[model samples]
Target: MSTSPDRVGVPASDGSDTVIDVAGLHMRYGPYEAVRGIDLHITRGEVFAFLGPNGAGKTTTAEILEGYRRRSGGQVTVLGEDPEHADASWRARIGVVLQETEPERDLTAEECLQLYAGYYPAPRDVHQTLALVGLAEQANVTATRLSGGQRRRLDVALALIGDPELLFLDEPTTGFDPSARRAAWDMVSGLRSLGVTVFLTTHYMDEAEYLADRVAVITQGRIVAEGPPGTLAGREHAPAEIAFTMPADTTVDDLPDPVRAAVAESTSGRVLVHAESTLHILGPLIRWAEGRHVDLPDLEVHRSSLEDVYLALTNPDAHTV
Candidate 1:
């Protein structure tokens, strides 16, 4: 097969064909409803990430999209066809790397890839697939003999053997070390360069931030927020946290007037200010410390991060009480 990928689907708003669309989707487990009327869209050649805590129905929703589960209600379309009714041809165009995959323990990685490749009409070269996932050296090793990171790479290689137009990755780099994780990121970047649509789920905010073009936060079986990684869940404008050690022999009462006023109004009692720029508060803090004849000690400033946004949205009930 040619290395150049065929164009898949597109987005709805831009007049391009949508790759995946879900409208008011719901899934039930007898008495309980897991997915509660959720809607989402994924465009062609884009990496869309889904973030949610355990039991928030993220996996349920993904399985429904993959045609593994029948929906209780609502509509779901993958590659412009209803996932529930799609045939084998539709399945051939999409590759899925699920969280828990157990190959025959005695089978070598190369053998496993070769076995799966036979099912596809136009699979990628086995050697190239193994190298793409950073498992080139471990091709001869049995699945039981490979390390956690190496095994994960094999899983990814199997997913790509079909040369799928769209790929689904569930926690793709969960067990990888730092270096291994970076390698996985590079591999995903290469996939994007080839114009393949990637849908992934990851708990590591940094991973999602690096890989996903757009991310959606699902909470209580609903999408609380959806946008680009930087702006999702209001992370772009969230307040920064500032902490500094008080000067030696200086009591809170001895602080400068302006500094004392600001500190007094702070509920945290540590001069926490919600400001756009840290410098804005730093200037006043430094001047006040000098006027009070006390030296500032160990100042630190940190802005809102994606982790903060995730915790805020996923655990709103914790904050509510």
Candidate 2:
């Protein structure tokens, strides 16, 4: 497949509902710089995924944005304030769910949320938040007794209890089964319609594809690509494949020149065409088959999946997080 990549994260804007505006973000541990010149603009009510391989500065950048760590140099603003210097009010407007956190083992789901709700000046209704994360049934279960997925939902409920405008979800569905994970996805998807911005980080490509409106990939401390999932790294522009089973009596020479020109292979009872222009190839092939009264019933067209594009960009050896 041909390779084409989108430009890095666009410059942060001022005249929009941009919830997170970052520019030239850099972080260093001694002389080793973990995060390079990173740039991002996450708008309000959008689910934006930050993806990268391990040791790619993903966590470092997130911490800097979350106010848990200091960047060596760069401009960062989340919720309209510099997190490094922002006050309590700034923190109150956002919520965060880390990859893993020890829950309050002694407290029931309802009690834990009730305890955290007191910390927020205007928390959402405790029961409503529980229902939102699919945890209403488990509200009376102790955190230690609840299933893994249930605890994760409780974490989400805790985060939402603050009525936060922005939520940072890091690997939110890590321990979930297929059904549980998809349920979490639905909950996160609903957050967008409620005008809550989400900054999501996940290793699962399908999760990112399903949940994010836009995504950015960071590797070796810099963004390599940024765009919508289908268009990111120009996955949408990759060559299309047109394939069909070769009729018993057919040969490549029997096909019209236009169709023949597009064929990548024709042997072993199958013909494959790499279509740079799908219509150009399809029309001629269909007409050729019609003229011969041949059935193209087995024909199919395929595009590169997001995983295919990502592997191309990161190389087969790179493991994502």
Judging by TM-score against the true structure, name the best candidate. Answer: 2
| TM-score, one value per model | 0.82, 0.89
User: In candidate 1, what are the lDDT values of residues 1-321, reduced to their tens digit?
Assistant: 333344332222344658889999988898888889999988898999988777788778888888899999998888878989987667777899898887667889998988887777667899999888888888888988888777777888898998887899988887789998998888888898777899888778888889999998887778888999988866767666676666667566765554455442333234554446556667888887778777656676777777778887888755520
What TM-score would you give candidate 2 relative to the actual structure?
0.89
Tell me how candidate 1 scores on lDDT. Answer: 0.79
What TM-score would candidate 1 get against the native? 0.82
lDDT by residue (tens digit), candidate 2, 1-321: 111133232233344698999999989899999998999999878899988767788778878888999889989999778999977666767898988798997999999999887776667889888999888888888888988888888888888887888899988887689999988999999887778999998767798899999989877898888999989987777788889986769888788888898888887879999998888899988999889988988999988777766666656476521
Q: What is the C-alpha lDDT of each candidate?
A: 0.79, 0.84
Please list the residue runs of candidate 1 whose C-alpha ends up more than 4 Å from where it truly belongs after superposition.
Answer: 1-17, 175-179, 246-261, 264-272, 276-279, 283-297, 319-321
- Give the number of the best model, judged by lDDT: 2
